[model samples]
Target chain A: MTETTLLTFLQWIDLVGVLFNAVLGAVIGRAARLDVVGLVVLAIMSGLGGGMIRDVMLQSGPPIAITDWRYITAALLGALIVMIVRVEGRLWDRIYPPIDALALGTWAAAGSLKTLEAGFGVLPALMLGTITAVGGGFVRDMVLRRIPGVLGGNTLYATAALAASLVAVGSWYLHVPTIGSIAATAVGAALVLLARWRRLSLPVG
Target chain B: MTETTLLTFLQWIDLVGVLFNAVLGAVIGRAARLDVVGLVVLAIMSGLGGGMIRDVMLQSGPPIAITDWRYITAALLGALIVMIVRVEGRLWDRIYPPIDALALGTWAAAGSLKTLEAGFGVLPALMLGTITAVGGGFVRDMVLRRIPGVLGGNTLYATAALAASLVAVGSWYLHVPTIGSIAATAVGAALVLLARWRRLSLPVG
Candidate 1:
């Protein structure tokens, strides 16, 4: 298939992932008691903040939103859905781990794809993929005046995404087919599950 | 005075301003129920976010901490002082406005100084100054899962910094004396004061 076709396919998947994270962000915002404007702001940040950072690093302007209206639309849809459901009570915290897992994997994939399309080398691609997966949430935490979840040893959270990004880089490097990258993502997800269930961690230096 | 003297003088003032703001950030963090780690994180975010973003936009890496430790030192000192002061209880919300003003003015000055040192043109220099002032807060807001105060309809918060930056830029373009930048910073502060008092706003497009 043409690079364009592959690129377009990747973009579509990223769209889904962004919206999923945005919804989760909105839920978190509501739990925090932020108003509507705050909700949209957080949703947008979750959906696009990392990509924006990545694009800026790559010297691209406007990043996610400038590319298309699709990202914004997806974030809006997800946020609306989350709010309309009016999920209440304390169980919402439990839902976080799962949503986080989904966002990490998909965003890693999107980051790798975009970086490659932008003609970056494998190293930059992998690095950016890690940033894309974790950067948004990290920014979200910092904005809320909290320590970044990744840095604070939240379930080997950043490592899971980093594993996926590295695998994607390796997959592309070896000229492997789509399944190689898929397998890599699965490996990442499996690690997250193991880490969460077992409460695992790498010793802090 | 020599260029080094001027630069050193500016850095000293900038350091003083950032240090106090960092303290303010920590105070707020503690008030918001964050632990030690959270307080440090917020202090750093409030102190360095703008300059870091500016560096990233200009493709500079690691920023202040990556090279000199002055910024970090200031941040730590700020946190330490705040912890010592134990500022809390009533009227905590009132602190935001004043702290915001101080940060805005300081960053505007720093941006202008850095831009002129780099020999950028008037427009970019002014913009860089403004960015230096508010970019950190914007990043902090995004991380905290909220809209940046700058992007919101807040009381011309960023605009005052922008005005200062523009004055610095224009003064340089017109070949004014070094003290012109000081005047520019004052102008920016005055604008912020006017806005806070009169609740001025540029109509949203």
Candidate 2:
């Protein structure tokens, strides 16, 4: 695919990721017995918070989550769907893992690309990419007064993000960012799925 | 005082706040039995996180924490002091509250003034101001797996920030931001002190 086409694809993935994460956030909020305001807050924060944090840290203009209308619309739609429908049990269990993994991959790729575009080095790109992938969940978990699962005892979520970021950065250095982004997403998502299947976890300190 | 003098004064307060917060963070880390690396991480985050969050959200330039040499130096010095000096017991108990309160006040004032200078309206100023005042402590609490004290059930820390921000914003409207900043700091610090003295707590939902 051409660069423009690849960029468009990444944007679409970012939007889809927002929608999925918003629904998941609402589900968690419901499980926590939160009120409607709390549910909406959680959904929006889980959908948009990571990107916001990344953009803010990049010192870029206002986050695209705020500048673009569609992002919030997608997140709100997700919240509405979760409030109206029962998105649980077997179907949710089967569907959530893959979608979540893909979201993480795409977000990491997008974050790394943006960091590179902003003229940062590889280390910053990798750090920001992982942060963009996991920051929303971190904020969500904090709001609920829980230890962030990615901090320890979970599958290799942060590591997968880091790997995806490294792949993207390497691709950027090789001057093939578009193809690298696609490869990074695939590698990241696959790693997440494999880790889950194998019950892989980093050892606790 | 002149605008230049006021600016200088605020900068000093900002630096002092970082030092105090870094020390506070190190104290907390010690209480948690964290290792040296963890203590340093907590100290830096507690010292600089709030201002960094505010500057990042402002999107005008790089965060002053990263750009300014003194901020990091102050934070590091704070960490070193706590690591070596055994900063607890009667001296800490007597000194901590007032210094902490003053830091909160100054941060809120600085945040609001900067927001207004960034051409944002009153609401953003208030929100960012409160975030600047409490964001570090909030992050510290989250990392420690505790609920942020400002969220609810504690003394009116967030409220004091809001009040200070409101005063600053109001002063900006009156075209006296320099004097307003000083007054806002005083009001915020006083409110915190009063809340503590009276053992006041917010109503929990």
Candidate 3:
């Protein structure tokens, strides 16, 4: 891709990710029966939440508080999309699991790769990877005054991020080619889906 | 303060801030009836939320993530404090709002002062001031899954930060005495209190 195309692609993906989360957030918020302000808050949390965590973990400082303002714009866009779309019914159910799965893998891959590019080591990269994939969504859920989705004993939320981070670490360790990382991430996400489909959990203390 | 003394004082104050937020977070998490892991997560969210936010807004990159793990240390310390203290009831209750207010004021003043020192204009400076004051708390509430305390129609959170920013900005502009900024900030906070008592609000769209 041309340089502009590359940048545009990344921005578009970011927007897509934000859009996905916004829709999910609104659905959750509606189920929670939150007010307008609450819905908006949840949408922002879902959209920018991971990036915020990634930024913090990367020592990049508050990304959204600065940046193109596009982050917030994307969040607002996502919120609007969800709000207008959800008035009818079931739009969220159509979107949630699959979009969440994609967001999980893509975000983890992006985070680990970006951290590596930023010259961090594998552990830091993985830490950031995990945070990126689940961090925003987690915060979004929590900020909506609910248990954070990732930690709420929900089906395999942070697990996807962890799987992706493992891929990042493994790729770094084996000095595998770039594509290996992506493949590993795909496998990890697929595993998350499997786990979710199986309702896999073991008793814990 | 002497350089060492100042650093120590700042760190001490920062520690106090961390502990304050930790207790507050634990209370909320416990009230929410979360598990230990959940409580830990909430504590982390509350403790570093503002400073991390100010860092992100400054685009300093993941404000707490870069250091050799100081943020983690702070988070743990805060959690430990809360854990040790929470054997009794309502300690967090007695401390929450007032400490939160102090944290907000400190961040707003400190952030605005830093922004002015960095040569930003008044608008950005004011904005930074507000973010610094409330950023962590906002993140805390968000992670706890509630509307941002700063943004929700509760206290005059943003107003206080704005007032401090104006003081910093006015001090920069007027070349006022060294303490003029402090005086202005006090006045601003007082105004916030007045607004709160009167149930005032910024104009809505």
DockQ of each: 0.08, 0.15, 0.15
Q: Clashing pairs in model 1?
A: A139-B143, A140-B143, A141-B143, A143-B140, A143-B143, A143-B144, A144-B144, B49-B136, B50-B136
Residue ranges of candidate 1 with Cα displaced over 4 Å: A1-12, A88-99, B1-52, B55-119, B122-205
Q: Is the docking of candidate 2 incorrect, acceptable, medium or high quality?
A: incorrect
DockQ sort, best first: 3, 2, 1
TM-score of each: 0.54, 0.64, 0.60
- Tens digits of lDDT, candidate 2, B1-205: 6799987998798789899999999888778766554465578779988988899778788677755667767887887888789999999999999988989999999999999999999999999999999999998887888878888877799999999999999999999988998899999999999999998887777
Interface RMSD for candidates 1 onward, in order? 8.3, 5.2, 4.3
Please, what are the lDDT tens digits per residue for candidate 1 over residues A56-114? 76654557665788988988887887778775457756765565576677677667756
lDDT of 3 by residue, A1-205 (tens): 4556654654465567777777677767878888877788888887777877676557643465247677788778777876676443466556566666766776777777777777766656766777887877776655555667565456665666767777766765677525545564575568667768898642220
A-chain TM-score of every model: 0.84, 0.97, 0.80
Error of 3 at A136 (Å): 6.1
Backbone atom clashes (below 3 Å) for every candidate: 9, 0, 27
lDDT of 3 by residue, B17-121 (tens): 666666667657667666444555667667766666666666644464334355556665665665566534476445555555555555566677667776677
> Which candidate order results from sorting by lDDT in descending order?
2, 1, 3
Give candidate 1's fnat, 2 decimals: 0.09
Give lDDT per model, in order.
0.70, 0.86, 0.65
Q: Residue B73: error of model 3 in Å?
A: 3.9
